[model samples]
Target: MLPRLIDEHWRRIGFTQRPKLAAIKHLCREVDLLHPQVDDNGRRPDNVEYPWTGASGSAEVPAHWKFPLMSRLHDPSGKLLLKAAVGLTRNPAMFIR
Candidate 1:
């Protein structure tokens, strides 16, 4: 379910390449600019788990999950990301229904 959503969103936005772990880290930093409160403890509501934890050990886990959502939202193109996020929060039943 989640992978599909990600693939579709990326495709729609013309992101021809999937992000590497390093790129993801960069995106997280960018998103953090918009949401300083979101950390990378893997405790955020929808946090992305650090994929290279085995290679980097526990030190690589993010403090928050905002990167996944924020990576999309922080794009300078438009506010669709924000709108989608707001929609999810405003209508919980949308997914549950």
Candidate 2:
């Protein structure tokens, strides 16, 4: 269910594209945007054990389950992104249909 949510919202707005993805990546590096990413301890909502000790970890997350949600300058959940996408290109006449 949640996986579909990301596709519908984020990717739908062109986040999956090379340009947008690169732009977001660059924006994050240029700014000091640090979002919550499941502290190094890998604390899960269910209190599960973290699998990594940061020995040979790559820059990007291994997987979604390995990371936590956070709000950074490059956060894909900014208010502007939500509002702009909301009701975008809606047909007013459809309300009557």
Candidate 3:
């Protein structure tokens, strides 16, 4: 989900002018893993959107879990991404070229 959204965002901005912060890529991957698609074999059922049974037979709700990305937001790369996002929102025309 996030991976595709990020790709579209960059596509709109154009590759040459897109911010170089590597954290955007990492964040997109992490976000995608959070909402994994269950394969036809029913494997990889874990996702952050719905409840799934753990290996120990306990029902786990992803909303109750603490994702690492929340903490990463305070780190350098995350800060860069946040800043760039805010900048884009403030002056969207700056990146339209």
Candidate 4:
């Protein structure tokens, strides 16, 4: 959802070009990882909204654990995402087509 919104914003602003900021790109990838899509085999187990069986044979709820993507919330990419989100919220018209 966030990546879609951000991509739309970039497109609207005519900013869809190569060499996107490394931090923002990393942040987008991390966000994407949070919402894994099940493949044909239905084997994608990592998700942020449900419980799944861990390798140790224990039920693991995402909310009860700090996933790697969650930990990136304190990193540079996360900070960039937060800043961009706040800017969008504060002045949405700037990105509106």
- Index of the highest-TM-score prediction: 4
lDDT of 1 at 60: 40
Measured with C-alpha atoms, the lDDT of residue 17 in candidate 3 is: 59
Q: Residues 1-97, candidate 4, lDDT per residue (tens digit)?
A: 4445566676776765722356567666666666756422455476787788887989989878676666776776576577667877898765466
Q: TM-scores, in order shown?
A: 0.26, 0.21, 0.56, 0.60
For model 2, the superposed segments whose C-alpha errors exceed 4 Å read: 1-70, 73-77, 89-97
In the range 33-59, model 2's lDDT, one tens digit per residue, is 222443424432211243333444543
Q: Is candidate 3 or candidate 4 better by lDDT?
A: 4
**Global Cα RMSD, each model:** 11.0, 11.9, 5.5, 4.7
- Model 3 lDDT per residue over 1-97, tens place: 3334444567776775554446678865555567657322465556778888877899978888677678987876676567656767787664454
lDDT string, candidate 1, 1-97, tens digits: 3223333556666778743334444443545544435545644323244332433244444463334454454453224434444655777444342
Model 3 quality (TM-score): 0.56
Rank order by TM-score, top first?
4, 3, 1, 2
Model 3 local distance difference test score: 0.64
lDDT of each: 0.44, 0.36, 0.64, 0.66
